[model samples]
Target: MTAIPPSPATAAPLGDGLRFAFGTLTVLPVRVTRWDRGAARTGMLCAPVAGLVVGLAAAALGTALLLLGTGPLLAAVGSAAVPAALTRGLHLDGLADTADGLGSGKPAADALQIMKRSDIGPFGVVTLLFVLLAQVAVLAQAYDGGWARGALAALVSATAARTALTLASRTGVPAARPEGLGAAVAGTVPVRAALLVLAAVTAAAASAGAAFGTYDLIRYALAVLAAVAAAELLLRHCTRRFGGVTGDVFGALAETAATAALVVLATG
Candidate 1:
């Protein structure tokens, strides 16, 4: 077997980290210069930054649509579509694959194979339908409240989605596969670093809400909490079912967190 390529020894950590995160996580044109664990570690740690970029894009489109006089429903749909487009729909696809795998009633190895197949199964299709509906419906509700609310909902939910990936990458999590994205990044993050990143994300979300009022601030933080909680439960379930986390599982977790965050943001 060929030996693994070394990390770019000369590159700055921040540059490599951003490249890895954007290159792997989005359809954006950033080139990934290194594939070694160093880059993966930083990539996972910097996931929220990439998520922030995606969230900003989503928020921008939604705000623009609203300013253009589109109805809340249309603006919500636009906002919801931005994340999918930016990620090339990979997370949504992962969510569907994971649902099919879990719903298959097969052994871990067998279920992995089912998820690896190109076509979506009944469970996958149904899960996608409901997940997309939840995202759009909640977004529409936020947009109905105001452009700021809609944009904040989009921004917070998107960031919370990737924040789950960072937490999921903490030291104890194992990769379900020997090869693939999951194995490359799983267990690479130190526990303290992951928690710190999560705290920062949650705090920033609350700060954004604080501009509105104390209640909004509390709900924003709670939205992040709800997102993390939902993703953690799913992460544990997927680990048990699949033997550990896969790329599909990561995607599922992101979508799960994002939808949960949106749902909470729509409240009050």
Candidate 2:
């Protein structure tokens, strides 16, 4: 089916935007007063802000563990678990569903249908296994460098991941279906808004690198650029394979971007 434009509405208030973002993106208890198209659009725009909160919390946990002389592996595991727990693993589920759909190599309809099934498939299983493992491994390596470095990486990666949502919602992007998140926010982001988000996230990443002293300016910028590149590629691939973006697609982009950012930081 062809994608439809969102209904006309005024820009969401900052209070409503925060409500929508925190309520939808995390399992945190927040009252969402508005559930309209405007709110959804604002939430997508503000997604990176929510990520900052999650990332900071996760980093704090890992840093605390490290300060207590916990092993890098344990610190890493704790750091990784914070976001997953706070977000109710919503993004991970998206990653799994997207992997399953893409791996099916069937028609778009069939693949989407496969993704909607509650049970995990072989593709989803394998993707989750490796992705989660990679997160732990890379995070552990970062922690080995120092608690501050590990915390900075986690913070930057989380912010970068959520920034992908804004890009995915840019104008001309289509919703895979007529209902749900894809329909609610797809094509809602304007070029100006997307650019602003990109700039903000880039600055945040650079600041993190400078604060940590582990990554030089060039390396940090490259890592952010690489993560953004990966997210864009995923968006294009999903559009081709699924005929448009879905809620799962948003999740997939966020997780993929986060992992890419973290991996780059760890390696650098």
Model 1: ten consecutive residues of lowest lDDT: 1-10
Residue pairs with clashing backbones, model 1: none
Which candidate leads in lDDT?
1
Q: How many residue pairs clash in each candidate?
A: 0, 0
Q: Please give the lDDT score at residue 253 for candidate 2.
A: 91
For candidate 2, the 10 contiguous residues with the lowest summed lDDT are 1-10
lDDT against the true structure, per candidate, is: 0.91, 0.84
- TM-score of every candidate: 0.95, 0.94
lDDT of 1 by residue, 83-184 (tens): 999999999999999999999999999999999999999999999999999999999999988999999999999999999999998878887888788887
Candidate 2, after superposition: displacement of residue 157 in Å?
A: 0.8
